[model samples]
Target chain A: MESLLRVEDLNVRYKSYRGELKVLDDVSFEVKVREKVGLIGESGCGKTTLLKSILRILPPNSIIYKGKIFFKNIEIIKANKNEIFKIRRENIGMIFQDPMSALNPFFKVKDQLYDALRYSVHNIKSQQDLQQMIIKLLKEVALSDSERILESYPFELSGGMRQRVCIALALTRSNDLLLADEPTTNLDVTIQEQILNLLRELVNKRGLSIVLVSHALGMVKEFVDKIYVMYAGQIVETASTDKIFSEPLHPYTKLLLSAVPRLTGRWKAEGLIGRLPDYVNPPPGCRFYMRCQQSNSNCKIKPKLLKLNKDHSVACWLYGDEEH
Target chain B: MKSLIISNETIKFLLKRGGSIIFTLIGLSILIFILARILPGDPARMAAGWTAPDWVIEEMRRKLGLDQPLHIQYIRWLSDVLKGDLGFSIYTKRSVTVDVLQYLPKTLELIFVAELFSITGGILLGILAGAFPYRLPDNVVRVMSYIAISMPAFVWAIILQLMFARIIPLFPAGGQLSSHIVPPPRITGSIFIDSIISGRFDALIDCLWHTILPALSLSFGSMMQNARILRMGMTDIKGKDYMVLSDALGLPLRLKIYKYQFRPASIPAITAMGMSIGADLGNAFLVENVYNWPGFSRYGVTAMLNKDLNAIVAVVLVVGIVYAIANFIVDLIILSLDPRIRRMSRSV
Candidate 1:
């Protein structure tokens, strides 16, 4: 399958009062057409920043220090804000975590959707066309009583209803790629399951190249084709979902899998031992060295990514040692 | 059913949170009484003289109803106050209602002009400033607002009078109309309104021209406040996920500000706007007096200096009532605009 979106060796930084905080350091990932890829990480692991950087939505102060994000065949890193905005609205659709807050508070749903249509649609005829497009989009999202939902404000709708409205609006132009940032994490368990199922259906139906970011890896496990486990602003492991979940390579992935509670049986799983290492004054060699169980001179010497199997890769000395 | 719901909500609000303003009124009234009592000059002595005999003082005091116990006096004043009789001003020998009515229009005219610039102009400037936050317009507004907010209205009025009125010769330093212009029957209590009503374009022109300096003086500060508030609100709002969502959705600039930022952000700012307005009115002491404008703020300053109890009380109450009403109207607006606040008030 052809790669629909590719992020090559991306590094992002935030200039704060303290210092230049390295948020995303040398992170590379890809999404193929009709492929569902889940980029999983804890909070402050730069998942949202990474997604936003791809969308070119960071505020004026933030700096994408190095690397390029290619959408289709074009490099967006050198693109101006107006150029980026034009591409993002028409070709790339994004959904935020809090659906209710993520939709404009004051505007009616139809108005918001119409605005989206105006940006996405190259040629427009009349008000009737806009209205028709809005109604059709609302129906597409599986919202009941399209007209009613269209007229209502964000405050009027329930959480799940609002999320669907957002999704419906996002899917109005039927874009190629969707960047979902922990879309189901804020929702209740049942609602979370429904949203995940909906996303899975969307991937299957729309042929969207989705880069789903989440801390809750379990939610995206069944849906995503591939998984990238990130730790301390770098991808520690990348594999097919089955390979990664069944037999993870990285020590961090092992810890992550062990941390998740099982649904069926009693599993005495100890959570990851320590907190994330500070990014500003990060440890000299390996960022995750302090927390790793296997501490050695080789471990102190930072290990780069190595491919073990056809579909799996791990950035650990154990893999490097085993390979040699 | 909705009417009942509204009235029930109003009743609950009045019974609960409304008590605070009334409590404020009572507390402020007591402070007024004490301030009057503790004042070195006695009403009788000041009205008469030191040599006025004890019998004369006693009789004069009795006639003025100053012999009653403080609490009883306060009760009579408060209750009669509820009946809308604010008592007669001893110095002016005029009913407080009539006195207030006489001066109310002038104060309101000044307020109207001030509000014109402050509310509408401020909103425009604020929207502009917010749209281009940290940009040239944004930075200009930031500095200008700081200046306007920091400098009192009186300072602006004086400086504007000195600059535009004196040097340029476009507008008068003071008064609502030109001295040569004889206003017809003061039907509307506002020169501009009366001019429009009478089909006098020249009068309207003259009135508006004369009002320029004071209104500009008043509005610059207010505009600064409005701009600052809007900028803060816009900055805060831009931080939200929804703004980015709106960006991804590709909403227009004007629609974003008008629909999204203005109402939600403005509701909070308008609530606090009453104090600025009331202060503008009250602080018009120097502006009114300097301009030789016959607004009640001038009367209030004289009353304060002369220790005129009735005049002082009347002025205080008028200022209080203006503040109270402004705040009430703001709340009403907030309740309509944001159902969240209304629901919170009802639930609480």
Candidate 2:
């Protein structure tokens, strides 16, 4: 499989008055060409941070201590200004969680879309050409009434409509990969399904890849081909979506699956016990060891992600025989 | 040409704003009139002179209608003001309207030049400081603005006069033009404009040369205030979601700052700039005294000192009107800058 985006040993930390919060601790992730990869994690698990790091868009105070994020063979972290800009404009596009804030309130939908288009498409001949290009982009996002949508500001649109516009903005100039950071987190349940479906359709139709960072297990199960379960700034497990659901290895992944409410039979949605480890002074071991019922004396040292089955990996003392 | 066609919403906004301004001016007039009446050193007494006998003082008081009931006096003054009669200034010994008309243009010209500098200098400094916050430029502007804002315009006027006028002798010390240059014919009543239109470049140069110290003194404080406000606004805007997205999209730094960041960040600064005009006019009096510029603010201070009731009221009213007009224009500018405000205007 051809890898479209690969992040290796990415350690990101945010500087605060207290100390450096190790947000992304030695995390490695990858997405293949035309693949839908879902990154599932709880709130403050650094799923969004991972996506931001991939695009090198993290805040000024955040330091990428050790990481190499390659988007289509271009090293994003160390790329020069112009090179990074070209990659962002032509290769990768990002869709933020809140569509309301993602779109600049002052600009009309048309202007924002046109502005993005203008950067990528230099020879955008005339006003009519630009107008037609925008109309086409709007149509691709399933937005009818292109004229009215173009004329209206972000505030004027509904949540779903704004999300649609955001998606359209992301798809400008034929981007190869879409980084959707909890794109449906702020939408209604029904709207969430619609947006997810729209995204899947767009990705498939364009032969484009996507890395969807989300907290909802059910949403990820329905949308992505593979899943990477993140717990406290580390990818604890990775497997085929169905395999993770059927035979989850990591204890945290097991707890997460058990927590999902069932529609039939005895609906016992067991809540996981314990809070996330404080990143400022994270335990030097499997981050989930505190909450893991299976923690032993061996759980004190950090566990590297070790493969136990074909196309399945888990970072746990129980899975790996190598003791270090 | 198309911009001249005001939308119905704008017309409604203007009418609503205009109506409120009139009410505010009326309220201001009543307040000023009452304050003027209660002030020490009676205007009638001032007009009559200390050597005048008891009967003459009484006659002066009667003639000036000082003995009339307060409300009657207010009504009389209001009616006369409505009829374009601002009464007479005992200090200037001229019609209050005439004195204001003569002095106001000079004051306005000074303010106009000062404002030009303040707006441009302030916004430029703001952009510079905001773009590189906490860096060398930002620190320099921060320290400079703090110092400038701490000092009043008059203090700056004295410092500037001493530096440029006396010690360096780069510019003239005081007044409108050099004594040798005969005054240009008052076409627009503004010496700068009159001199230019009448093809007297030498007089125009002299007028401008005399203006620099006073204008710099008047502008420094307000310009610093504008810079601080806009810098804060721009810094706050830097962390917005759109700004992050713009960075994610790798939009050019200049494009993001000018196109995306500037408009939203400029709102607070624009509001401050508008309100600063009123403060500037008030401060201009002290500055005028220091620079010896013959402007309306000087007349206003003299009117207050001599208890020139009519002149004081007229000056206060004019200042209020100018302030209100400035705010109205600012409201319009804000509306245009922010589409959200435009939407709000419709609901209003």
Candidate 3:
């Protein structure tokens, strides 16, 4: 399958009052057409930064030191403003973490959707045509009260309902790739499950590609075909979801898997010990070296992401050629 | 049924706000009365003059009802106010209400023009500053607004009069119109409106030309205040997530500014406008005195200096009532603009 998006050797930095913070360090990932990929990490691991870099939505102070993001063979990092805007309008849709702040507060739902349609879709001719499209999109998101919902402001809706409206908005233009950045983080657990299931069903029905970013291993484990475990701004391991869950290669990945609580298991839950390395002046070699129990003098030099099997890749000395 | 419910809500809103305004006006009347009495010079003595004998001063005090107890005087003044009698101006010897009616329009006209200048100029400058913040245009606006805010209205009035009237010879230095031209027949009592109604184009031109310096001077502080408020609001709104959504969706810049940004950012500016109206009216006193403009503010100054009790009270009451009404209108506008406020009102 052809990849829909590819990010290569991406490094991002944020200039703060103290100094430059290295946010993303040589991160590389890919999403194939109609594939469900999950980016799993603890908070501040640069997962959201990676997603934003792909969309070119990083804050004004952030500097991209060296990186290349390609969407369907077009290098977005090198693209001009108009070209990037066209690509974002036509190809990519994003669902933010906080639905309340995502939508404009002063505008009615229908007005916001109308603005999206006028820019994204070219075939919209009249108000009636736009209204029909919005109604259909809302129904697809399982919101039956389309008319009332369209007239109401964003603040008037419940959190779950607002998120559904946001989902409907993302799907308005039939986007090829959807970036769900912790889409269920602000919702209740029951609503989170419903939204997850809804997303899974939509992806299957429409053959949509998605990159779901979350810190919850259990949530990402349920629907994603592939998972990338990131720690301190670097991808530690990438593998098929079942393979990673069954046997996590990187030590950080193993600790993460152990952290999840299971009802009937011999495993004793334990969190990864130690804080994230300060990004302003991170340590040389592996970012997780201070917390890794398997580190040796050989681990001082950073290990490259090396392929172990056809479908599994790990970036640690344990997975190096000498070990095999 | 919907219309009836809406009307009912309107009535309730009016009663609540109106009751508060009325209470405020009464409190203001009492305060102004006490303060006027506390002023050093006695109105009866001032009217009788220093050379007048004790019996003459006593006769003047009796005629003016100044010999009564303070509470009795307050009740008498309140009854007279309720009966539509504002009493007589000690200086002009005309009814206080009549004198106010003549001078009030001049001050109102000045305030109206000043407000027009400030609101339009301030909002535009604010939009420019906010849209390209930290850029050249924003830097220029910031420096200019700072200068405007720091200078008093009287200083601005003097500088403008010197520059435009004396040095540049562009406009008249003082007064509402040139002494040679007779004003148009009074309809609304505002020279601009009266001239337009009577179809006196020359008078209208002269009236507007004369207002240029005074109006600019009067509006400078308020303009700066409004610009600062709106710029702050817009800068804050620019960072909101919705703005990010707009950029990601590729919405046109003009549409984004007008539809998405301007309304929410303008709420603070609108509220500032209401508060500034009362302040501008007060500041008009100094501007009017500097320019020698015949307005209610000039009358107020004269009344206070000459110890004209009735005239002073009348001016204070009018200003208080105008301030209250301006706030009431602003509240309605806010209610319409913000749904949160409307919801709050409903709960109340």
Local distance difference test, each candidate: 0.77, 0.89, 0.87
Q: Residue by residue across B133-152, what tens digits does model 2's lDDT show?
A: 98999999999998999998
TM-score of chain A of 1: 0.94
DockQ of each: 0.55, 0.73, 0.64
Residue-level error in angstroms, candidate 1, position B177 = 2.6
lDDT of 2 by residue, A1-324 (tens): 899889999999999999999989989999999999999878899999998887788988999999898888888888998888888888888999999898888878887888888888346988999998889888989998999999898999999999999898788733689999999999998899999999999999999889998877788898899999999999999999999999999999998888889878869899988899998999998889899999998888889889777889999888865743
* Off by more than 4 A, model 2: A121-123, B1-5, B346-348
| Ten contiguous residues with the weakest lDDT in model 3 chain A | A166-175
Tell how far residue A42 is off in model 3, in angstroms. 1.4
Model 3, A209-261: lDDT tens digits are 99999866788999899999999999989999999999999999998888877
- The worst-scoring run of ten residues by lDDT in candidate 1 chain B lies at B1-10
Question: lDDT score, residue A311, model 1?
Answer: 84
Query: Of the native A-B interface contacts, what share survives in model 2?
Result: 0.65
Worst-scoring 10-residue span by lDDT in model 2 chain A: A315-324
Compare the candidates by lDDT and give the number of the best one.
2
- After best superposition, candidate 3 residue B157: deviation in angstroms? 1.6
Worst 10 residues of 3 chain B by lDDT: B1-10
Model 3 segments more than 4 A misplaced: A266-268, A298-300, A321-324, B1-11, B344-348
